[model samples]
Target: MMHNVSHVRFFFLSGFNETVNFKVALFSLTFMSYCVVVLVNVALIVIIILDKNMHEPMYILLCTFCMNGLYGTTSFYPKMLWDLLSPIHVISYSECIVQALVMYSFACCDLSILSVMAYDRYVAICRPLKYHSIMSKQRVLLLACFSWLTPFSISAINIILTSRLKLCSPYIDRLFCMNWVIVKLACFPTETIVNNIVSYVTIIIYLFHGLFIVWSYMYVIKTCVNSLENRAKFMQTCVPHLTSLLIFLITALFSVFNTLFGSTLPPTIQNVIAIELLIISPMMNPLVYGFKLTLIRNRILGGITLQMK
Candidate 1:
């Protein structure tokens, strides 16, 4: 029962750590991760964009994953960096609210992109001959557009409803900017409404996405069993996608566990899992995909060498 308030705002207590040394280390690590995450994803996008040889649907979906990585880092890096550098870490009420929404949106985009990638693999493996006709350039473009648009629409709805509420204090409990934390901190009666909307969004994104992934793998398994020639390629494709999904699912599970079990796990452990699932997963995607797929890596290296030459 959150009230529709326009003029109300909140104060965020960002200076949580008393030790200066901790802040310095946090800043250093954040700086390094931000650089690496951006570089790797940008490299992936550039490789796919420049290499006409790699203009297949799989690479196109990989490009979307790279974009999702950028969006994911953007949602938190700015504030985290700000908090690390300044002696007193602080964020405005509106800023926190917007960050919350952006966090969810980025998250939504990430899961959606991964789901699309899995589907791409399914098409590539299960329907090899029809892959080209089915996943034509136009269709790939349409799918990419839908991936972006779907998340943006859902994010907009969640944020619009979220922004309508009045937050008492912006002192969110959890680390690294989360919607749940901010929403929980907001002293509003209609917080339930916000949570309910979030609940609905979560169900829609994760449930359907998870179901599609399971279905894709099911078909993938069937294809694997029937085909002997391209078994290695098909299995390789499934590995990274499944690895990424499992890592993501584990993180989601922990968060749900912490919330439901009320076990009072240390916030540090929770943050570590969050960082692993967010920063670590995106950074690893390029390597995971590249190492597992010979063609992708070769194309990337060839693209780099060609540039240098």
Candidate 2:
């Protein structure tokens, strides 16, 4: 018998059961990792904001990217750290929904921002004379808003639809709440038809976001091939964006495939796959950009030298 949706007050997270013996070690490592993530992302954001020269379109988009990384990781790490210490691994229904909203929106916004970054680069290299006019501060602001709001709205709709279902169980088998996992807990298959439809539509929409990035890069690379100047520009600006995109795609795809098909895998391996995006992408993106971008690297090293003096 399916339970009443109104009575579903909390969810038991079953992923932590196996970690009870090593929770302390896990907590210390996780806490340290979260600290490093925050430190590096914030350092980049601060570098971008403090230097007037860093206020260009590429840096602004990078700041937004790091901000999004912080936002995404914040949703996962605090609760995870708390759960590591607490014996009962449960979350209130409303809290679970909120977590799902932030987590999915964060992921979607990542792809959207990356797409915008690709467009920004394309305009910079392929259409050099029109670059400033096209990627003006006002236009970039508009694009940034679109990147964030569109994904949040789409994620919110999915979460709202999932929230309507009468769930058959309150046990979430993973470490964190996910929109699809919640939908899967619905009492009736017929009730989830709309949910499945909307889910596919949302996936298709982001699939296009991925395609747009590819299209933008194709034009970018072709333009960069002939001119030494454009190739230099590409090495300086576009490489970091490409690296970040590759990291995001790899980690995001791992999580997606693991979610869809890793049921038979060992729980430890499954857990690693699920959290890969959260841990690897968030931590690596800032480091990749910080070290790769010349201006940012000089500013950081200059500051370090000044402090050492």
Candidate 3:
């Protein structure tokens, strides 16, 4: 009889190895953060769904964005909370891959959704006469689906390629499973050429997303410069979107650059950078949108007051 064994069936996450002394504190903070993330995101999602006035393209896109934030954070925080409680910090191979998929898809989809939001704002501010026709509910739904499905498909391809490699090590130095980190574990460096190509391509694709956002904002800024009404609209609406985008890109690029170059930093700092996107974006998106967009804010206040009554 012949036996076929897996090369690596699990990965040991070393991100928290040195920080175990603060496990209780870390768990407390993470759990509280996770609760806030869920509550805020879900609240926004529900408010958008229930309010007919907010059924516009911008709010709908914001709703999808929050949903994606929730999706991504759920993938990390639960397992992370568990690992924080456990002495052994390990993840099964399949679970790791799925986590990587969820994370990448969530992030890429976020950029995609943001791009759509940028377009929505551009149309509203720049081409108001055609905004309704261009961003109809059907069109909005299509764009939202495209934003989500395209990233998921891209991430699935990357994970599929990763699954075929024969891993040289079972240890991951980070707090969670990232696709690039998994690629680095391949037994032979030559085997990862395709993965690298795919990753760069993915990066370039999202880089264009960033460019779209920049170009959109440039035109928006230029348009708002001369008109007081446009300026008020910009401050009232577009600022939140831009803030979310800024936070997202900064945290995401920090992680990517740190992973590729920040070898000299302590593991604690690296861990902080690695999880910054998950921590900051999920919490910030809803708060920014919830407070900045008045309709949703009033709806929430109304709901709370009714509850109090």
Report the number of the highest-TM-score candidate. Answer: 2
Candidate 1 lDDT for residue 274: 52
Question: Which of the two, 1 or 3, has more TM-score?
Answer: 3
- Residue 147 displacement (Å), model 2: 0.5
Query: How much lDDT does each candidate structure score?
Result: 0.73, 0.92, 0.91
Minimal lDDT window, size 10, model 1: 10-19
- What lDDT score is found at residue 108 in candidate 1? 73
TM-score of each: 0.88, 0.97, 0.96
Sort by TM-score, top down from the best: 2, 3, 1
Per-residue error for 75 in candidate 2, Å, reads 0.8
Residue 290's lDDT within candidate 3 is: 89
Model 1 spans > 4 angstroms off: 1-3, 6-10, 13-15, 18-20, 188-191, 259-263, 302-309
Query: Worst lDDT window (10 residues) for model 3?
Result: 1-10
- Predicted structure 3: lDDT: 0.91
Q: How would the candidate models be sorted by lDDT, starting from the highest?
A: 2, 3, 1
Which tens-of-lDDT digit does each residue in 105-128 have in candidate 1? 776777787788888888888888
All models, RMSD in angstroms: 2.8, 1.8, 2.0
Please give, for residues 1-309, the per-residue lDDT of candidate 3 as tens digits. Answer: 112223898999998797789999999999999999999999999999988999999999999999999999999999999999999999999999999999889889989999999999999999989999999999999999999999999999998888888887999999899998898888888878899899999999999998998999899999999999999999999999989989988998898889778789988888898898999999999999989899988998999999999
* Clash number for candidate 2: 0
Candidate 2 regions with alpha-carbon error over 4 angstroms: 1-4
Candidate 2 residue lDDT tens string, 1-309: 344354678999999987899999999999999999999999999999999998999999999999999999999999999999999999999999999999999999999999999999999999999989999999999999999999999999999988888987889988999998898888889989998899899999999999999999999999989999999999988998999999989988888888789898898888888888899988999998889888999988999999999
